[model samples]
Target chain A: MTSRVIFPHKVLPYLLLVPQIAITLVFFYWPASQALRQSTLREDPFGLVTTFVGLGNFRQVLSDPDYIGSVQTTIIFSAATALIPMAIALVLAVMADKVIKGRGFYRTLMIWPYAVAPAIAGMLWLFLFNPTIGTFAYMLRRAGYDWDPLLNGNQAMLMIIMAAAWKQISYNFLFFVAGLQAIPKSLLEAAAVDGAREVKRFWTIVFPLLAPTSFFLLVVNTVYAFFDTFGIIHAVTSGGPGKATETLVYKVYNDGFVNLMLGSSAAQSVILMGIVIALTAIQFRYVERKVHYA
Target chain B: MPERTEAGTTSRSRRSPWVSHAVLIAGILIVVFPIYYTFVASTLSLQQILRPPLQLLPGSHFLDNYYEALFGGLGRVGGINVWTLLLNTSIVALSVAVGKIVISILSAYAIVFFRFPFRMTFFWVIFITLMLPVEVRILPTYKVMVDLGLIDTYTGLTLPLMASATATLLFRQFFMTIPGELLEAARVDGAGPWRFFFDFVLPLSKTNIAALFVILFIYGWTQYLWPLLVTNSNDMNTIIIALRKMISYADADTQWHLVMVTTIFAILPPVAVVVLMQRWFVKGLVETEK
Candidate 1:
């Protein structure tokens, strides 16, 4: 925000800006613009024809049962991925926050999963739950419960959800730990002196103080579930058994890359982009509310 | 709030510590389980994996599986060895990181320090790109890559992914914190923008550069859909895509041992970066989010 003393140079700044702008235009903007155009135009799979369809593509996508189902899948998937990770991370963070012993070691052991790619997370779980080869799946069968992610939609959804949530726990945990540390120790001590129990102190004081962090993680985890978990669905279930795990992002990939339905896919992309923009707006709005809370 | 001190040395005081430890230990186990499974599975033979309830502990096949994984034991994916896959991945990851840092730094410098027309416009342009990830624009971006004749090449793999709004914003924020007196001093010495940037600004940016490198490297290394779409040849395939191909386990005769070995290989570099540079990785992540 500071307007610092400027070193006088007209050409140099433009020169500095060129590479990033050029790359952005060529890669991000041009393609984004092309998606906007393509969304309004239907194209055959052969790559030879085009027809301007306007809202027809959007209409088709909105009315399609598959698209409707995918929207539902996305909501469920996003909520579980967001809530489960945040809940686990909050508990772990609270527990870890209690003691100083082995804190660094526990953090080191916990946070490395943030480095695992989404697809790799899917693969890791895929092997663990493989009907015959997977250790956990084998155990499930041994307990007299039928377990086949490959065949069952609920099981497949659960598999991808677990993988996605597992990968995200580290991220949320790190943030929650940071948030927990940011809380003033004096406040907790004051609460204790007032005869407030640990549970009472956490629920009344700590949890309220962590609202901003909780809300931030909620948006981030939701956005992640929407855009980033495509790899999980793509690898684990490929939206399979019966389109059980096909999130909106996965549907976008499948429509364009797999099925070659250009118009529909482009339309879906526009809708997704709009959703993200709205989510960003909501984040900013809630962040403003948190300023008052703090 | 995780603990409370009782004045009378009550019964609840001593028992609370154990509860916290128990919960923390249980969390650590669940977090470490999958990676541990991968390591243990890699140490076992194929027969062990085929049967249900594989050994929980490491088996006796470590060298055999890792040797196979590293030395082309898996089937020919685009006719490339697993070693080549590792090499390609490293190249893509490093190039994307370095490329992003360089361009983003330059752009951030321009936008932050110099007053220029359309500066705010350019900043907003970059900001909007954050909302449009590769997932949404895959079709058109793939077409552009095809048109540019970059498919399956290193340029194709890293270049498109290098245009980063986050890195630029990070640099811009960091540069703002540098005192304006430095710029005044440099200007009074008759140093030009280019000279001052190289001698003054970049030196201050070293830690940021390193931090961004760790974050971006992991990002590029773990990319699934983009690299999967662009790099059609196995010779050009990164470890992630190669691993995915290896484990279409339902249809193919997946060598579970070798697959596990490759999983470790795929995970090692980025995880190494995170663990080794834990301080900077955390700092960089928290800063970027802000």
Candidate 2:
């Protein structure tokens, strides 16, 4: 991992590393350790007292109906967030790949959404879905649907999903386009010689070739729905119409910052950290395997 | 990977161009429509926005709406000027981007150039942090910020976020590609590590640094949950958080016109960066993730 002509100086290297290490120790490791330690201890409502609860916090969080519901909500949220964006992105990317006209123009126009803040994405969609002033809400009501995200849990969940998915589409579209472009033109032509139509060619050849990228995107998208969509939920639904849209990350924020449940939130954070570590491990593993092939 | 495929090319040319263009145009419309509506809304009067059958075209109130949003008078948004929020956001974004690049490149240099005890240890410590996003550890991190009295400060907003592994990893990967012969030659010429780094390494790193700056600046700009937790005062709010405040949804009188104006202002800088620096943006994102 090091150069052959390495610096023999000990203190200089350590000094070079000190700033990053110091920041990591203080901000990352310290808080992480605090979360681990605090997960075993319960604190009273006032800033005064604490009691050792051992694994009680974990038990409480794991067994809570609300927390269980959040896990399910996160799964659904992540799945929809992953699937919808990837599907739409794949469709768009394939279509863009087929035609040569205005190729760069289409790409530049489509990816602007990637630059919009997730919170602002929520705001944009929220404006469109607001019952009173929302254009879509007006259309929905005109179509005789009882459409109010404010009062409807399902509608709130859908709103956040749409907003989150919208933000992610450009990112997925870029990757999918990249992945699609990497497939050798010969393969598609080879399939064409065998009488495979575009649909058959895509299913038998292109789809199989995109497996690695699709898998990588799946994990990344899951982690995103778990974490990055915090803005979308916060700005759009705030985890409500009665906790219906509270993903695991939002629950950590709500329980810790809003409700002042330290031990519980810490336990939840510990769990979330574990989940992320696992996800990152999977991503890196795929990356390494791809590197080996390359 | 280009092929002649004369027959294939002819057949593909005969394939329906209308269908692909139609689907692509539809996709573009979905992606661009929200942003277009935001622009359209920002140009309209509040009465026009709330009134039924809102005009799809840009209205005559564009200057007045933007002027009000930039100055003040966003009702229920706590008297914070858009200028103050923009300043806070730019400061935090710049600091995070610059801070991350500086510290990461140095540590990467240390790891790559020197052999020391616990060198692997330090590498793992930094590398492991790639997984721990701020959202995963907000509470304890917030408590630490509170204890250190960093809460509600620019330092709090930027510093904690700067302990990033992605930049360090990116720099490490870039550093590995620097031919060892350059360093050997520098040493034979009696150049010290600092001199060699400044003269040779830093110049080589310029493109990488610029690309990374484009990505990290956007990362810093788009942060929401961290700023939402850390900055309690209106004065400390970033434009994103301020927009959230302005459009709290619970508030009935959320001057939609003004909020739309602020939304446009909030996203324009980063979107401009991404569009203008498309090459660097793509390179930074793709390579860093890998």
Candidate 3:
């Protein structure tokens, strides 16, 4: 009787977590474990018996030039996407902050791009960049400069980066606005009294205070650019005229779903997961220290 | 001296009302122009769209383009029905939103208000999952869905995403701000945990719940990748995927008009939701971040 009473008192709190645990196990852990298992095996179509390939699949995926190129593309894409949006967002936020009027209007307008779905965003841009009928293409032709993202690697990469950055600017703006708002008004007043100019005040006082928000956005944006761009890439270019836009996640989706290389795809997924985890851990450990809580 | 200077500075800093309106109007134009362009493009003919300098105004071909895009036509592989896609997308989004909110509230209540062993560890585990991208886990998730016989079903699209670690974390942080005395008082009044949760806690959390609802609804509605992977039939496909299929079909001959029409149709619902629920969405972000 005593044990029963104690059990209800003690375990009731933990019991509430049961739903979350169950869902995560089924959706997250089970699939993750299955992926790990599949990564180690060589399974053919028709669900036939699979042989243990050990590290063979990993070696093949890693050594292939296409996969190596994808890694390079992933790194460049992630870095550019993360850094560019952040820089643009920071500038916009500062400008918006300095403006004496229409703060709410600016905030709302700036965040508008985030509302559009990624696939639609890609389609929208694709229409704008269409070779035969595109507005931008027509304008370029008028200017005597031939423009076709479909034909050039550099242009394709630029298109992906621009599209990703455009969608992400709103998110970055939101966070930056929130971060800017969190700065105590008294500090700004004090800096103004100290004869610090607007730019100087921002660089020294405001920027340091916004570090935590920046760091958080950096990690989130990197992951987003790394993994979330798959849908856009799939919709817009399908990795393009010469596989110029194929990032790691895109390759995984292509191999697993389109190419029907389930085992090899699983191996690629594992490698992708490892790289992301390592990058995230390193960012959290190193960059997080610079964040000013106050 | 400081007081006088501060008052003078405040007076100097205040901008004229006209200036504020001008800034707001300019900002609004920049933001709304692309969407306006989309609507205009949707109304024009293919030839008009291809014309140099582009048509800045809406054309008379809106109905025809929309009709052809929605129903298959010459040079179009159109099998999509927009209404059906919208219904499917809404069903999936609503279920995920409701499921995620309920689960998150319960999990957060347990973690924040009660004394439980391994609580910190559990929280860490939940946080860790946030770092693990869905891309890495998609294959395994697909296999599990297949095993459960969920393929091409609404349940398959909704179930895996129904429980979000981010929501749980947000709720946990929100719950922590509530006073312990409220819970203790309810307990002293002979209220059990469930009764206390329903009677005392939930009513106070309406704003947070609403905010979470908007965010989750938008996230779920706009979800493309997983749904695209799982659903095979046009009947089962959501609006975003349907948009993608339409665009790909229009790729070769490049029917800009039809593509624009379908794109506008695809974007309308989510944009409506966002504009309508903007207050709650912004509120939720501010509250959770705090």
Q: Candidate 3: misplaced stretches above 4 Å?
A: A1-15, A44-49, A279-292, B1-32, B62-78, B114-125, B251-255, B286-290
Per-residue alpha-carbon lDDT of candidate 2 for residues A1-294, written as tens digits (9 for 90 to 100): 432787667799999899999999998888888888989999888968899999999999999999999999999999999989999999998888877778888888887988889999998888888898888898899899999999999999999999999999988888888888778787788788788888888899999988887888898898888898999998888999899999999999999888989999999999998999999999988988888645
- Residue range B1-290, candidate 3, lDDT tens digits: 23334543363345454554555465455455666778888898888876745678888998888887666542433455666777898898899999999988998887776666797888877767765667987777887888899889988898778767778877876676677677667777888878878897799889989888877887888798889878987789888887777777664475667667767877787677766778887778655641
Top model number, DockQ: 2
Chain B TM-score, candidate 3? Answer: 0.85
Write candidate 3's Cα lDDT for A177-251 as tens digits.
778877876777788778877668778989998888887788878878887777788888888768799999899
- Give the TM-scores of the predictions, in the order they appear: 0.95, 0.96, 0.89
Full ranking by TM-score: 2, 1, 3
Residue B235, candidate 2: Cα error in Å is 0.9
| DockQ value of candidate 3 | 0.45
Best candidate, TM-score-wise? 2
Write candidate 1's Cα lDDT for B1-290 as tens digits. Answer: 34433432242244467888899999999888998898899899988888868788899998888877777646735456778888999999999999999999999999988988898999998878788899889899999999999998999999888889889988998999989989899889988888889999999998888889999999999898889889887788889888877776445476777878888888888899899999888877765663
Off by over 4 Å in 1: A44-49, A284-294, B1-15, B76-79
